[model samples]
Target: MDYSALRRRMVESQLRTNKITDDAVLDAMGEVPRELFVPRALKSIAYLDEDLQIAPGRYLMEPMVLGRLLHLAEVKASDQAMVIGCGNGYSAAVLARIANSVVAVESDAALAQKAQELLVDLGASNVNLARAPLTAGYPAKAPYDVILFDGAVQQIPDSIVGQLAVGGRLVAVLQADGPGRAILATRTEAGLSQRVVFDCSVPSLPGFAKAPSFVF
Candidate 1:
């Protein structure tokens, strides 16, 4: 398969048409080999316009969705960022290119190890890969300027919100009321304010599912 051509087409067609206009984001997406992030069996479909399941119930977001989320995060060169569910570290590698520093958290031990190897191979010196529960944000590197959940979730726990610095921003695809919505939540002195950015369908992260309530 001609992976390079496929990747270029993905950027020009899916990404550009979808409004991922940031030159930096586009360049990163174009240059980074998406095939390297997926298992060998699925490398051929790496650039396809869909999510590739990385594990049981876990998937890497489609390129367009990820690019849009990064653009919305407004990553700055001086910003400190954290990425939740850093599956294979593709998002962290992209964030590393734009942000000053990045802490990528992954819950699956095997995936975390794979991400670490890939990040090192990619020479992403500014990004650190850590293994932790998906819902439990890395507190040791708390107060991030930006927090990105690479997958969908049912709720954003205070445990995660507490890691953000005042005035910081968090972007995630959350299940609001019913269908999934991409939301940008910002921290303020008064409280957190959330706004839905777009409608999206993404695989939910494990351990983030809301428990059912008993009724009479």
Candidate 2:
């Protein structure tokens, strides 16, 4: 299979058509072999515009969704980044090309192991794969220049927001009501300020759903 051709098509059709205008992000999305990050049985659909389920309750975000978020974050070549719910490190691989270094945090052990191996195989040396709770946000590698969640969340926990360096940008698809909205929050002197960027459809990461409230 010609992965290069498929990736090119994905960039042109899914990403470009969806407003992923950043050159660096387009380059990275076109370079990363998304097939390797997905189950072998599903490799044929790896470059599709939809998300691929890489593990139980874990998904690789849709190409356009990830691309748009990365474009909005504007990851610089010198920036340090952290990806929450990295799912097989596909996002980490794409991020490694844009950021100086990336710390990928995954909550599932099996998924983390797969991500580590795949990242190593792909020569994504700049990424550090850590197995930890998704909501905890890997504080040991705190103060990142950018933080991204690869999946939707009911809310952006303070634990994750607090890990961002001043001026850092964090982006995620926030689910509420009937659908999810993509938002970007920048850490500022006053605090994190957020604005909705676009409407998105994506599954929530493992641990970010809001707990149920009591009823009368």
Could you give candidate 2's per-residue lDDT for residues 1-216 as a string of tens digits?
888899999999998998889999999999999999989999998998898888877899999999999999999999999999998899999999999999999988888899999999999999999889988989998899999999999988888888999999999999967789999999889988899999989988877778899999
Q: Give TM per candidate.
A: 0.95, 0.98
In model 1, what lDDT does residue 209 have? 79
Residue 74 shift from truth in candidate 2, angstroms:
0.6
TM-score of predicted structure 2:
0.98
lDDT of 1 by residue, 133-197 (tens): 88898999888999999988888888999999888889999874678898888889999999988
The residue ranges of model 1 lying beyond 4 angstroms of the native Cα positions read none
Worst 10 residues of 2 by lDDT: 203-212
Write down the lDDT that model 2 would get.
Answer: 0.92
Q: What is the C-alpha RMSD of each candidate to the true structure, in Å?
A: 1.4, 0.9
